[model samples]
Target: MAKVSISLDAELVVEVMVLAGIGSPQDAIEAVVRDYVVRGHRTEARTELKDRNLREVDAKPQEPQG
Candidate 1:
């Protein structure tokens, strides 16, 4: 894994640390980043499925009943 540095709000960092029960900001940030990446990839795959002809099958409009 490549190392990268990012600046985060102190308050936000504290909040994440508390919620994650982690001692370091790095773990919280990595967990959040990994979740974000996974979600993004899932969304992108869904879009590709739509692009690949998953047509919406709308029910034919029924004629007014006599």
Candidate 2:
């Protein structure tokens, strides 16, 4: 684990600690970052699937073989 030194809004830190039910500021921030990263990955995957489906729909259909 890496140690980071950052300055955050004092009140916001207190709020995150309460909202996240975490005892430390570091834990709260880590939790929030993790959630954000996960959401971004999910969104990227959904977009790729949507684009692929659209391409498939736009392609010409082939005739059936006898």
Candidate 3:
């Protein structure tokens, strides 16, 4: 992927790094952004499937095997 640089507050970056448990600032920001994108995709998929006629499965527990 292409790379670019931007300035951010040191305090904010530190906060994100700690919250994400990543020692590197770049990796921490990248991880958070990637997760946000994934969540957006998931939300879009759920909304699109909301009106679809999908089959539901009911799972039942089986007796324990000896």
Is candidate 2 or 3 superior in TM-score?
2
lDDT of 2 by residue, 1-66 (tens): 878799999999999999999999989988988999999999999999999999998796978889
Cα lDDT of model 3 by residue, 1-66, tens digit: 899899999999999999999999999999999999999999989977764534322244557899
Model 1: per-residue lDDT, tens digit, 1-66?
788888989999989889888889999878878889999999999998876654443344557897
Model 1 steric clash pairs: none
Clashes of each: 0, 0, 0
State in Å the error of residue 39, model 2.
0.6
In candidate 1 the C-alpha lDDT for residue 63 amounts to 75
What's the lDDT of the predicted structure labeled candidate 1? Answer: 0.84
C-alpha positional error of residue 33 in candidate 1 after TM-score superposition, expressed in Å = 0.5
Candidate 2 lands at a TM-score of 0.79
Q: Model 1 residue 35 lDDT? A: 84
Q: Candidates ranked by lDDT, best first?
A: 2, 3, 1
